[model samples]
Target: MSVLDCGCGPGTITQGIAQIVAPGKVIGCDLEPGMVERAAALAEGANLDNLSFQVGNILDLPFEDNTFDAVLSCAVTEHLGEPVKAMSELGRVVKRGGVVGITRTDWAAHMIAPSCGAVNRFFELFESGFNLQGGTMNGGRNLPSMLGEAGLNVVDVLIALSGAYTPEPGNAMVNGWAEWIENLPLFDRVIEEGLTTRDELDAMCAEMREWGAQPGTIAATGGCRVVARKD
Candidate 1:
């Protein structure tokens, strides 16, 4: 069956879906022109003739009503100010009896072993900044309700808790959290708001790295996957 992957960055998921559906087509859509170009190039390199990429807004999809047999999005709704509206659009594009799958992370549910008060404070500041930027840090918890509100029947919900205690420098879970923390502009906002000082932030970062490298330390995050269908 035909599929639509919303915000299909670099066409990774789109190509996978295309392979799964074989003769069926998969369209990868993203709002950024650069991402669309990158996705197109990747699909081309993979020789996925059944896959294509397009630049389009999630709030206003480019297709007509009931255009796709299945629609999927991952890690997208949290960035939206109107996630339910986007869900409505996703639902609107799927034909009757089609499936819609969405997965999102709940940042509030993150767990870190050997937790320090300073690190927790840092995360609090980060959450504040995320809210200030119009993001829903707890969006994953609202998926089922959003899908139901969008007139889709919620069929299944999967909760995946990811954790790692490896000392390896590039461990996906550890490195992912570290990279996200390092790249966050929230620290700047926190400093500007007088919530914390640069020295304190630096200290926290050092502590985080040290804690991550220590034996028996663990870092974990929560993800929610929802599958819904249009009846």
Candidate 2:
């Protein structure tokens, strides 16, 4: 099967799919040339002869109509101002009877244990900061509607929660959040936008770490994946 992975950053997932669809071709597309280069390098390192990478936009995919047997995108829609348009483009690239799959993180559904005013304030600031950056916090919950609107038949929906209960540095969710908080530019942006002060953000980060250490504490975020068929 010929497959296209839209918004495939570094081609991690695209490489995995290439392995699964051995002897079949897979193209990983991203908007950033650097990302394309990184993906291409990884594919070459993996010796994946059937895999390739290209720089392209989701809103206007570079592929011809009905060029792919399947299309897949992950963790991309929330950043898009016109998600439906991108979805339609995904649908357009798939051959009839082919499939399209998308997954998104629902930022609004994220929860931290031992709720308190400080924790609430932290999330409020996070949400506001994301919005100020032109992101949709609730994009995951709207996957089915978006796919349907794009003229695809929704075949399956999967929702899952992921987080860390212990203060394990290797835990992906924990590390991801920590890295985001520690990114100097993002931190500065939040402060510049008046979402919160540096001191308050630091306090919240410390509190979050403390909470992660507590017994039975969990910091979880929801994700949704939708599989659709172009009929």
Candidate 3:
């Protein structure tokens, strides 16, 4: 089957799908040229003939109508500036009876830690800015309706992958933040507001790690995995 993996970042899911498809083809498409290039390089390095990469956005895809047998998108809808139109675009490109699989992560708690009143306030301010200036951040709840409006026949709506997603501090997750915290823009953001001192933030980060490791303290996010067919 010819599958189109929309917003396929760094070939994470695309690489897995490529293994399953084997000789069949999968196209990993993303708006970021760098991501497309990296995905292409990874596929080539692995010598996987089933996978390829394209720099494109779902809001205005480069492919012809009825081209792909299945269209798959994950963790991408919330980033779009116009998700409703993007859903319609997905339907407009796929063939009749083609499947559209979707996955999401509604991570509100992650955006702001549940405890730490100061940290909570800090995250609220940070996220509020994103919400105000950023184009769109609608989770999957809004997408099912958008899919219906897009004229795709709803086949099944189910959970994609629902389980614990707590990021253990000092693990890969904390290091990721540690690396990103230096980003002048985000660093300046927290400091400008005087939300929390760097040392306190560091301690809070340690607390996040501790809480994430403890059983039952880490909360998992629920996501919707929708299966729709083009009529």
Clashes of each: 0, 0, 1
- The regions of model 2 sitting more than 4 angstroms off are 114-122, 167-172, 184-186
Q: Which is the winner by TM-score between candidate 1 and candidate 3?
A: 1
User: What are the lDDT scores of the predictions, listed in order?
Assistant: 0.82, 0.82, 0.69
**Deviation (Å) of 158 in candidate 3:** 1.9
Candidate 2 on 1-231: residue-level lDDT in tens? Answer: 999999999999999999999899999999999999998887776888899999999999888999999999998888777889999999999999999999988867876765645556655666676677777656698899999999999999998886766544333454355456767465678899776787887777766565555556667878899999999
Candidate 1 lands at a TM-score of 0.89
Error of 1 at 194 (Å): 4.2
| CA shift of 212, model 1, Å | 1.5
Error of 2 at 80 (Å): 0.9
Candidate 3 whole-model C-alpha lDDT, 0 to 1: 0.69
lDDT of 3 by residue, 109-166 (tens): 2432344343344344445434444433236566677788888877888754344444
